[model samples]
Target: MTDDKIQELIGRCAERDVLAFEQLVRQFQSYAFALAMRLLCNEEEASDAVQESFVRVWKHLDRYDRGRKFTTWLYTIVTNISLDRLRAIKRNRRLFSSRDEDPSIDDIQDERDLHEIHSNEELAGMIRALTDELPLKQRLVFTLRDLQDLSVEEVSEASGMSIGSVKTNLHYARRRIRQRMAEKYNVERLES
Candidate 1:
């Protein structure tokens, strides 16, 4: 949807117009879910996060700044909620058991062809798998900047990080992911 249309919907939503709120949800729900899924890596949790995000959005519509992009604000909410869900899962898992073993990077054969990775879905899955080994901040920055295709500034806004922090995290995140990818598939070089 166009920014103007989204802004109009937001304006109506702010006035407590239920239909406009519904329309706004329809317009952005998929984007929100996609982001949540990338962050959470589980469909059920992603759905829950998106639902909670919309609820929060509805409750706090008045606080949304008109000058900033609506998506930036929405993404901020989703990122924060997703991070909370991740922390909760970690806490719960810790209560139940000891730490999970790290996947053996040594199992990846060096001769696998990168060209064989044809589907975007497969590549995305591989990237997500690689990201599972990253620290939370690096994963967030990498997902927001590279996977979600947000600008650095937009990632910073969404993640509530300083621009410099986002860049630094993204640099390390990309470098690490690329190293893993090369080790997995034997690529000669990867661009940062």
Candidate 2:
């Protein structure tokens, strides 16, 4: 939808128009859920985080600044909620363990279709698994900028980080992902 249309929806939403809110939700829900999934590294938690973020957005609709890009504001809300959920889950796990854990392929919900980003199921699984190895900041930067195709400025604004920080995090994220993918490829080659 165009910015003008979204602005109209936001205006209506601020007035408590349920239908307008639904329209906005329908437009953005998939992307928001995708982002949350990448950030939390779990399907169920991502769904919950998106739901909670939308609820918060609904409650604070009147507080939204019309001067800003609505999607950027929406991303900010979703990212904050997902990060909080991630931190809470991590904290609980840390309380019960003495070491950090890496998410395995089994933990990721594979939903890629043949026409989607990656047609190779095995490669898709490897990418998802390797993504979980990044630090939280790096993961968010990589997901927003590279996966979601947001510009550096948009990612910086959405993530509430400086442009330089976003660039730095994205640099580290790409480097780590490349290193992990290469290592995995080498292992599979050797096994064969």
Candidate 3:
């Protein structure tokens, strides 16, 4: 949907129009959930985060600036919530020590090779797994840039970082992904 349409919806949503709110939810659900998933790395948590964000957005709809891009503003909300969720999860995991650690990439070579023969979904899953190895900022940058196809400026805006930081994080993310692919899959393409 276009920004104008989204702005119209937001205007209606600000008045507590249920249909307009539903329309907004329908339009941005996938984008919101995908971003949450990338940040949280858990399907259930991502789903919860998306739902919670919508509730928060609904309650705060009047605060939305109509002059700005609606989707960008919505993304900022979901991204902040997802980051908070991630931090909470990390703290809980550290407190409980309930989750077993994953094996190193080298140890998962056989599984990685098998994953390579599958469809793009499998490849995406492998990439997501590799992303978990990256630092949080780098992972967010990579997901926003490579997966979501956001521009550097958009990523910088969403991440609250400078454009140069976004570029550097993306560079490190791509390099790490390529290095992992080479080590695990024996694939040697220069371009990802």
Candidate 4:
């Protein structure tokens, strides 16, 4: 959908037009859900987070600034909600664990061959393991800036991090992931 149209929908939402809000939800729900899934790593939890996020958006529509990119603001809400849910789940898991099960890196299913645009899921388990090993901030920054293809500034804004912090985290995240990839695949990454 066009930005102008989305803004129009937002304006209508601010005016309490339920249909407009529904339209806006329809336009962006898939992207939001995908982001939620990436963060939460579970379909059910991601669904719950996405639903709650839209409700939160509706409740706080008036606080949205028209000058901001709608996607960035929307992503901010989704990321925050998903991270909160993830933290809660992790806390609960640590509190009530029996046998320790290590979810380590493994091989991937090589499907599509993506070019230098960035790596694709050559090995799904390996990629996920590499990502999961990252600290939360680094993981979030790496996913937002690289996987989601958001600009550095956009990721910083959506993640509520300073631009410098975002860059640093992304740098570390990518370097680590690449190192792991090299070990797993025996391909040296050229330093850029």
Model 1 agreement with the true structure over 18-40: per-residue lDDT tens digits: 99999999989999998998888
Relative to the unseen true structure, what is the C-alpha lDDT of residue 3 in candidate 2, on a scale of 0 to 100?
Answer: 90
- Deviation from native of the Cα of residue 48 in model 1, angstroms: 0.5
Q: All candidates' TM-scores?
A: 0.84, 0.80, 0.82, 0.84
Clashing pairs in 2: none
| Residue pairs that clash (backbone atoms under 3 angstroms), model 1 | none
Q: Tell me how far the alpha carbon of residue 36 in candidate 1 is from the true structure, in angstroms, after superposition.
A: 0.5
| Residue 111's lDDT in candidate 2 | 29
Could you give me the TM-score of model 4 versus the true structure? 0.84
Q: After superposition, how far is residue 173 of candidate 1 from its true place, in Å?
A: 0.8
Better of 1 and 4 by lDDT: 1
TM-score, candidate number 3: 0.82
lDDT (Cα, 0-100) at 35 in candidate 3: 83
**Best candidate, lDDT-wise?**
1
- Assess each prediction's global lDDT (C-alpha) against the native: 0.84, 0.79, 0.78, 0.79
Please give, for residues 62-88, the per-residue lDDT of candidate 4 as tens digits: 889999998988999999999999789
| Candidate 3 stretches greater than 4 Å from native | 98-125, 190-192
Model 1 CA deviation exceeding 4 Å by range? 97-125, 189-192
For residue 188, what is the lDDT in candidate 2?
28
| Residue 64's lDDT in candidate 3 | 79
Instruction: Please give the lDDT score at residue 162 for candidate 1.
Output: 99
